[model samples]
Structures are given as C-alpha cells and as structure tokens.
Target: MAAETSFANASRRPRPLTLVAIVLLHLAAIYGLARAFAPDAVASVEDSVLSTITVTVETKQFEPPPPPEPEPEPDAGEQGNEGRKAVPREVVAPEPRIVVKPAPPAPKASSTGAADTSGARDQGTGTGAGGTGTGTGSGNGGSGQGGGVATKPEWIGGRINNARDYPIPPGGRQARVGTEVVVKVTVGTDGRASDCSVFRPSPDAEADAITCRLVVQRLRFRPATDAAGNPVAAPFYWRQRWF
Candidate 1:
C-alpha cells in the first residue's frame, strides 16, 4: 500500500517528457491556426498595436530678414546742384538826361544919311518926314511915320481876278463898260481867309457881292509875318473889273 501510494503521487506529479511533448504539440496547433488565418490576422494585430502608440514632433520658429540701409545725401558742390533753385538778383534803372537850347539873335537895323537913332524902318514910296532906313526918305530931324517890317499877303494859287476864275455878274446886270469890285479880306495865321467885305461896290450890287464870295472860296495865302518873322493875321486887298 505504501508503494502504490508513492506510485500514484508520481503519476499525479506528471512526467517531464510528456509535459514537453504536450507543450510542443500546443505550439504546433497555434502555428497551424496562424497559417489557417494567414498573414491577415497578424497584420491586423500589428496595426492595432501601432495605432495605440503616440509620437511627438518638435517645430522650430524662423526669424525674418534684416531691413535695407538708406542711401547717402549728395554734397552742395555735386553735379546734382544743377536742379536746385537759384537766388534772385537786384536791378537798377539809369537816370534821365536833360538838354537846353539857346534863342536866336535880333536882326540888324538900317541907317540913313543923317544916321537917325530910331529903331524903326521906312517903307513909304515917297519922301517921309524922318526915318532910319532907305526908300524915299528925307527927314533927319524927327521920327518918321515908319513901323516894323511889314509884308503883303500873296495868293496861294495865283494872282486874283483871272476872268475864268472870277466871272462877271450873271444876267448882264452891269451894262457899263468900266464895272469894278474891290474887297478887303482878313487872312488868319493858318493862311486861310477868315473874313471878307466889299470895299468899293460896282454899278450892280450882285457884282460886288460875288467878288467877296469868290475871294474867300478860291484864295489861300502864305500868311504875312511880323518884324519878328512870326505868322500874323493880316488884311488883303483885291480888285476885279469887268469889261
């Protein structure tokens, strides 16, 4: 009974070879199951394990580039000065000049035989009482009836009384052969007839009136000058006779 009990305990303890063989048989069965399911089941288990694992990546910060430098300013004596503004200059005007002229000298006076001291001239055709100048003078004791130099006015176109220009009275009013008309006309400084009047009337009044009208219309004179040679208004005498 003691030996049987010892044998029964040994049997219950399990043999080493049988345990090894059973472990090998279980491994073979697992290998066979893996082959049956193929590589699909193995890949799914690897993907599950890899998906559960977490990976961390670090990011680096980048800095910006530096700013560009500014350009230098040009000097005053540089060629760029041609574009600069120019300073203004002051201007001056010249002074005006003045001039003066001298007056003319007085005319010389004529002397006679007795050497009269008076400054007047003698213009009479006949003998005078007393005069300093020549032309039919006989007086030496007193001042003569002489005055300043005088000149008669002359017609601008020609001598008056030309029959064609100054015709006789119309309608033959004057039957007399010796019909005459005389007029006195005043000439202005501008050599124009300013006024006229009949000095001597003809037999016919129409003849006398026509003489003065024609004188003013057709006559213009070189105005008479005084002793000083300046133009002066003077009287002019004209006569017209009809045959």
Candidate 2:
C-alpha cells in the first residue's frame, strides 16, 4: 500500500513541467524596435496649377485651274466672225497677293506738369501750389547732373500737346541771367495753353522769349480734371519762365 501511495504521488508531482514551460516562454518572448527623425522636419503642402494650352493649326493654299479655251464656232463657208460685230466679253483681273507692313508709331504729346499742390517752392507763387515761381523763363533749365538727362518719349498727344520739354544747348550758358517773373495764368480744362505771360522771366529778352514760346506753342497741359478727378477738355494757361 505504501509503494502504491508513492507511485501515485510521483505521477501527480506535475511531471517536471519542462516542454510546456518552454512553449509558454517562447510565446511570451517580445522583439525590441527603434526610430528617429530629423531636426528640420516639416509638413509639406500640395498645390495644383492649370496651364493655358493652345492648339496648333496648319493650312495649305490651292491655286485655281486655268480657264478652258473657247470652242471654235462652226465655219460658215470659211468665213470667220472677226468682223461680225463680235460680242465684248467681260474681263476679270487676276488677284495679286501682297504683304503689308505695320505703320510707324505716332508722335507722343506731353502737357505741362501737374500744378504742385504741396506748399514747397513749386512753380513759385507765394500763394503756394497755385502761386507762380520766381525767375524768368527760357526753353529749358540748364543740363542736369549727368552729361545728358533722361527724357521720356512723347506719344500722348491727341490733337496736340503743346508743352514740350526742350533741351537747353550745352554751349548756351555764360552766367545766370536776371530777376525771375512769375505769372499765374488760369487755364481752362482744354489742353490749349492760353492766358500766357511771363509767370517767371529772366532779365534778358532771350529768356523772356522762352516764356512766350512756351505759352504760344510749346506749353501744353493735360486736360483739366473735374471735381470727381475725371479728365475733361478745357482751356488752360501757360505759366512759363526761364532763369
């Protein structure tokens, strides 16, 4: 009986639990993993643009076929109809193809500059922007800093822009001339330079002539603007001078 008890205990002693423990340990095993990122990493945005596409066209020209020769009329006893008051046929002229060139650009027109509204030394009237400037007038001021100053190409003239900027000749100066005269001419909305007098004049007659020329022919103003800032055609004055 004691031997039987020992055998029973040995059978129930958990059978040294080796293969089951190994399978459980294998199932519990886990693998390790690692990851890294750059310091300047940023999210990106995507955009799409539609491009203009054009289709290419090809063309072929064809020439007209020659006119058929007139059938000879039946002979009437060997008599030709050359003298029988032959009917006059209408003649068609051939169409000729010629290439045309583009026309040259028209001359641009410029007006006297906008009246300086700022209270600076502008057109030199003591009354401010509306006031005239000191000094007599001439064709243009002395040449500026560079050997030649830049001038804009004139093309804005409609009927005509009289205010043209004339370059003063390089050899035309000896010394500065006399007291400047300032004239305040009220110009109408039209581009014409009217009521012209010496707004500013040099002491010399030549200088004053510059003012007259500007008033009569060269001085132009953009059409006067209305209260709403829209451009309207009207008469305006030439406040010209040279010094």
Candidate 3:
C-alpha cells in the first residue's frame, strides 16, 4: 500500500511539470501568429510611403541638321548663241528716178551807159552829191544790212575827211600813198561805237592803226533796229580813203 502512494505522488509532480510546459508552448504559438500579422502591417505602411514618393526621369531631344547651300547661277555670256543669229527678211524693190535737162542762161545785154545803171541798181547803190557814195555791201555770206533790210551807217558829212586831223606817224604819208584801209565798227545799243578793228588791214601799219582810231573816236551811228523795231547793237564795216 505505501508503494502505491509513492507512485501516485510521482505521477502528480510530472503532471504539474507537463501543464507548465503546455502553457509555455501555448505562449510560443501566440508569438509566432503575432509575428506573421506584424509583417503584413509593415508592408501596408511601406505602401503609403512608396506612393507619396515620385521619381521623374528627363529625356534629351536632338535637333536636325541645317539644309545645304544652293548652287550659283550660270553666267549669261556662257549661254548658247541660238538667239543671236541673223534672220532672213523679205526684200522690196525701189522706184526709179527721172532726169530732166536744165534751161539755158539768157543772152547778155548791150549798151554801156544803160548797162552801168542796171549794174549799179543790181549792186544796191545810188550816186551821192559830189560823186561820193554809200552802198549796201555783202559780208559774212549775208547782206551788210541790219535786221535783214538794206541800210548804211551815215557819216556827219563834211570836208573834214575824218582822219585828216589825226597826227601822221613817221613814214605814214609815204606808206599809205595808194592803199585803202577798211575798218569794222561795232555799235552798241546806246548808238555809240563800242569797238573798232581793222577789217581789211593795209600794207601800211600806220594806216591800219589810224583807221581803227579814227573810226572809234570820230564815228557815230544810229543803232540798228530789229524787225520788232527794238534798238540793237550792229556791226558796221567802213572803207577809209586817204587823199
């Protein structure tokens, strides 16, 4: 009976140790389940953090190359000569011209005195008192008349012989014995002689020089008028005679 009681005590003590071991095992199982749930919660928190952070990558763009330069134009001289050729053209005949003979000149007139008078009229001259005369001379391929009408410059007539008073230079009388001097006088609008030049120079220098001086100093004129009757400067040619 004592042996049976000792066995019962030993069994009871083992039962207490087993119960404690079971309690420890149950705590270990609970800890394993909590660890597993904690990992899921950590994953959820990391999802929010990852969603808040955004990363952007920048891309580079490349530019295309520029177009090439254009070629130069060709020179005009280097072009072909097709447009420069001479073209054949139609020809027309010209009309013929006629020739006619000219009439013969009239016969010459006879009678010396009548012929002399007719010649004088043709020369545009009239005899003056004392056989002295004035004439409408021809010059410069035109009439010496002013404004296209026959006219002559008049001298204040007298026996003064205009240049007689002019002091004769040495050898003047001998040099100018047979020669005549002609002078050209340019009259101004004011009716006064503006210039005097030797128109026909004489062999004698004294005669040429005296002719210009006598005309410029002693000659006066009525200024010629135009067709409109306006007074104008006219050129007058005068012949000087010395006795």
Candidate 4:
C-alpha cells in the first residue's frame, strides 16, 4: 500500500525526461520554420529595394562647342563702318562773347551835364510838373505808392520820341494803327503836360498798337508841385505813338 501511494504522487509530479524532449522538439520545429521562410521573405524584401532598372547606354566622351568666328577688320576712309567727319580746316580760338551780364544798366551814364530838354522838352508851364526829377525810378512793379520819395528822369524836360506824329496812311480804310509807345515823359512841377509822348514806335501797325497800349497803361506820375511842394494843377503831356 505505501509503494502504491508513492507511485501515484510521483506520477502526478511530472517527470523531466519527456517534458525536456517535448520542449526540444518544439524548438527545433520553430527553428526550421524561421530558417526556411525567413530566407524567402528576405529575398522578397531585397527585390523591393531594386525598384527600377538602370540600363547604362555608354557611348563616347562629351566635347565642348566650337569657338565663335573672328570679327571683320574695319576700312580706313569711313569712320568704323559708316560716314566719317571731315578734318577741320584750321584751328580757331573760340570768341570771347561779351555776356554783358546786363552791366547793371551802366549806372545811367552819370549825366555830367544838365538835363537836356531841347527836343519837345517842357516849357516849365506852372501847371503841375512833378519836379526836376520827374521820372519814375526803376519800377519794381510793386503796387505800393511812393513814400514822399522823388525820382529823377533819365532825360529831364525832354520829350520821349513818339511815332503817332506821322500821319496815318491815307489808303482805303487806313487802319488806325495804334501806337506802340514807350513814352519817356518828363512831368513838370505843375502837374500839367511839360513833355510827354511815345518813346518809340514800330513800323508795323499791330506791333505798334501793342506797345502803345502797354506804355499808356504803365504811365504814372506825381503831379508837378510848386516850390512849396504843393501839387500843381496842370495837364501833363504824355507823348503817345508807336515805333
């Protein structure tokens, strides 16, 4: 009875011999499956690596392009290719052109003598001549009136040359050629016409008219004053005509 119980327990406690053998068999099967299938799978993977075929068509070594052709030489007579300039006849120094910087108007040629009133100059009629210096100084075109300042004329008592003195052409409807007047009027001290008229006139009627209009519009003068500096009441003459 004791022997039978020990045998039963031994049987229940698995024996190592068969277990080890069974384990070794299972490992061998696994190793065989890995070996046989792994190589084939690796081959398939390697096939995927070489996706495209590179067929080399080796021919010959490459060569660069040929050099460009040289440019043609130029002819002697013609400049480069076209017409050439003629040689200068002689060397001439450039002239010294007097730019005249407008010369500040020559300081009005300081009158070493008294004012010349001979040519149609005023008679000093006590009407209202401005004064000895009746000329409007260099006009600045400013609209402001003078501040009791007196200005002298370039030629006192002298009548500015006018063109209206000539009789208009007496031909079919003789066009009334207005004067192109630049009257250098000399206003007397009496405010009356001492000496006044157009300065120059143009032979052309139209041109003369324009000048006359401009000069007339520009006429301005302080009435001639008496010795007391009072404005004289007289008609100052403004020569009117055209060159």
Q: Identify the leading candidate in terms of TM-score.
A: 1
> Global lDDT for candidate 2?
0.37
TM-score of every candidate: 0.34, 0.23, 0.34, 0.19
- Relative to the true structure, candidate 2 has a C-alpha RMSD (angstroms) of 42.8
Question: Per-residue lDDT of 5-68 in model 2, one digit per residue for the tens?
Answer: 9999887765447778977776555211111232222111111111122122111111224449
Runs of candidate 4 exceeding 4 Å displacement = 1-168, 204-243
Please give the RMSD of candidate 3 to the true structure: 55.5
lDDT of 4 by residue, 1-243 (tens): 999999899889857998999999999998778768797875676668643422221111112244498697443221122222223222332344776444322222333333321123332333223333223333335575434423322223323333333333455113433423333344445323334344444445553444344333444445654445565433332333322
Question: What's the best-to-worst order under lDDT?
Answer: 1, 3, 4, 2
Give the TM-score comparing model 3 with the true structure, all chains together.
Answer: 0.34
Candidate with best lDDT: 1
Off by over 4 Å in 3: 1-172
Model 2, residue 1: distance off in Å is: 99
RMSD of 4: 49.5
lDDT of 4 at 235: 34
For residues 100-153, write the lDDT of model 3, one tens digit per residue. Answer: 654332224333232211222222223222232232322225344535423434
